[model samples]
Target: MAAPAATAAPSVPPSLSLPPSQFARIQPHAYLLAHLSPPSASNQPSIRANGRAPSQFRVTSANAGSLTHTNGSAVVRIGDTAAVCGVRAELLHTEDIASWSVSQASSSNKRRRLADLGEKPTEEDEDEDPEDDRAHIEDLNLLVPNISLSTGCAPGFIPGAAPSALAQSLSHQILSLLHSTRLVRADDLRVWYQQPNLGPEEPERHNENEQMDVDAEQSATIEDKPREIKAFWVLHIDIMIISLAGNPFDAAWAAVLAALRDTKLPKAWWDVDNETIVCSDSVSDARKLSLRGLPVASSFGVFEADAAAGWRANVIPDATEQTQTGKKGSPERWILADPDGYEEGLIQERACIVVDKQKDGKTTIVKMEKNGGWTVDTEDLRQLVEISAQRWDEMKRILDQC
Candidate 1:
C-alpha cells in the first residue's frame, strides 16, 4: 500500500519543443519572416529561411553533353531546382513546306528590286528588319521547344500526367524568347543545292567565235540559277524538370542555353545521286549553333513583413506614432532573390529580368516581367537589372567551362 501511494508524476516542461522542420511545416510564413527580420538587439544579419542573404542567389552548376543520343544535351541545377534539356535536329525538306516556294519567291523578288536600286543589303539593314528573321522561324516552326513537368519533380505534379499549365506557359515563354532574340540564324539551318544549268543547244562550229559564244551562253545560264534551299534543320528542343523547388523558368532556360551551346549539328548536304539530304557520320564535320547572344535570366520575390501570422509578427511602429515621434522606421518589405518553394508560396509579387552583357561592359535587358503586386518600382527594376548582370556573368562562366 505504501509503495503504491507515491510514484510521483514526473514533472513536464512548461512548453512543448518542435524541430525546425516541424516548425516550418506548421507555420511557414512566420518561420520565414522570423529569419528575414530577426530582432534588432540580436545583432544578426537578415537572412532567408534557407540561410541566404536577401540578395543572394543559390549556387549554380551545369554540365553539357550529358545525353549521348541527343544532338545536344545539358543538365543545369540552381540550388534544388534542376532541369535537363536536349536538342535534336531533324531535316525538313523544302517540298514538305507548303509555303516555302511562295516565301522564297517573294524574298528573291524583293532582293532583285533592291539590287536594281543599287542598294546592297548590309548587316545594319538586317538588324533593322528583325521581323524577317522572326517570321522565318515562326512561320516554318524551325525551333520546336516543349517542356514536361509530369515527372513527379515536385509536389502536385503526378507522374505520367498530362502536361500542366506551368509546362505550357514555360514552353510558350521559351518560344517567344527564341523568336524575339533570333538566337538561331535561318542561314545556318538552310541546306542549299545548286541546280545544274542546261543551256540551249548550239550548232557545232569549228571556230574560236563559236567557242566564245558558247562560253557566254553558259555563263548567262549559270547566272540565272541561284542556289536553292533544299532543306532546313528543324531543332526539337525538349526540356524535362528533374527537380523543381522553385524558380523553374531560370533553371529551364539555363539548361536550354547550355544544351544549345553544346549542340553540334552534323554536316549535311543534298546528295545529287540519292536526291535527298545526307549527313556526315564523322564528329569532326559537325558544327555548333551560332547563338546570337548569351542572355541570362534572374528571378526575384517580394516578401511583406506584415504578411506573417500575428503571433510572430515584427514590432513595426504605426505611421501616426512615427510621425508624432519624428523617427524613421525600418522598411517592412524585402526583395528576395531566387526564392525557394516555401518563400514562393507566401510571396505574391515576383519579377524576372533577362539580361545580356555587351562587350562594352553594358547590360542589355532582353526581357523584364513582373506581376502579382505593385511594390516593385522602376528603381527596384534597375537594381534587379544590376543583379541580373552579375548572374549573367556567372552563367556565362559556367557555360564556357562546360
Candidate 2:
C-alpha cells in the first residue's frame, strides 16, 4: 500500500476574518473631523472620538482584591479596555529552584567559548550578559506573568488553540520588564530557614584547661542551629483580557500593579519534628509582599497626518498666514494617548514608557519600548517623559486608594 497523503494547511490566515482588500482603514478623525475642526478654512481636528484631546486619557476605574480565593486580584478599566489580574502564591522546595545568575553565566561563557571555536560572542551575544560571578547569585524565577487574549475578547483569537503571537509577545515584554527593572527583588521572596549541624563545628582537639566532665563538656560545646530555609515565594500572575478597546499594555499593567499591592503571604514556620513548613491561618499573621518600586506604564500612538505647513516654511507669518497655518495639516500628525482599537489600526508608530517616583519625589524611567516603524527625536522623548510622569503619579494615587 502507498503511504498516506500529507494534509495541506488552510491558505488563509486564521487571524483575518475577511480578505485584506475588504478592510478599509478609517481613523477617528475621519468621523470626528466636522465636530473637532475649526469653522475656518482649516478643517484640522483639535479633538478625537468622544471629544478627547490628544494627550487626554479615557476615564479609568479600578477595584482591587476582588477574588477571595486568590492571594490578590484587581480589575482595571480604561475607557472600553479592561483587564482582570489575579496573583497566586505557591510554595516551592529549596531543592527545586536553580540560581538564575549561575545558569546565565554558564550559558554566556559557553556561547563565548563556542564563538572562539567557530562563532563570536561579540556578534551573537552582544546584548547577552558577558559573565558574572555565581557565588552570590540569586534565583529570579519567583515571579511569572501570563497574558491571555481569549476568543471572546477579540475577533482574531481562536478558542482552545495555542497562545496567539500577540499574547506570547506581550507576556515576554511583561517578563522582561519585571527582570530588567528589578521591580520585585528575589531577596524579598526568600524564606529564610537554617538547619542544625549536629556534628562539632570546630576541631575536636582536647583542651587541657577543661573543667567539666568529658561527656558533659562534649554535649555543652554547641547549641542546636535554628530551624530555617533559604527558600523563596513563587508568584503566578494571570491576566485575562476582559475587553480590549486598545492600549492593552497600560490596562494590563494597571491590573497587575493593583493586584500585587493587594497580595499578602501567610506566616510560615518550620516544623522541626515533621521536617516541613507550617503556615498560620490567621489573617493578622500574614505579611505583605516586599515591593521595590511601584512602576507605571503608559503607551502613546503617533499618527502621521498631513498637517498644512505653508507657514512652516515662511520666515514670518502675518495674521492671515498664521491663521491658515492651523489648517495646514489634514489628518495631520497627532500624538494620541491610550489609543482605542480604531485609532490603533491607523497608527504609524507606537511608544511605551514605564516609570516610578523615588523617595525624593523625582520620577524615574524604569523601561521604555518603541516599535511600529516610527521615528522619534529628542523633543518627542521629552514629551513622553512629561506625559509618563503625570500618569505615574495618577496611578500611584489610584493604587493607594485601592
Clashes of each: 0, 11
Please list the residue runs of candidate 2 whose C-alpha ends up more than 4 Å from where it truly belongs after superposition: 1-29, 32-45, 98-140, 195-230, 306-331
lDDT of 1: 0.85
TM-score for each predicted model, relative to the true structure: 0.88, 0.70
Local lDDT at 190 for model 2: 49
| Residue 92 lDDT in candidate 2 | 78
Instruction: Residues 1-402, candidate 2: write the lDDT tens digits.
Output: 999999998797568454322432333444434334556677655877557888888888889999999989999999998999999988776656565446546665786687579964442233223232112122446678999986778776768889878788888887777766665545445466655546534556477444335445555554322233445578999999878888888898889889988888888766678866678999999877677688889999876543223233343445334333546433346778888887786665699989888999898988887875434556788898899899887887778887
**TM-score winner:** 1
lDDT of each: 0.85, 0.71
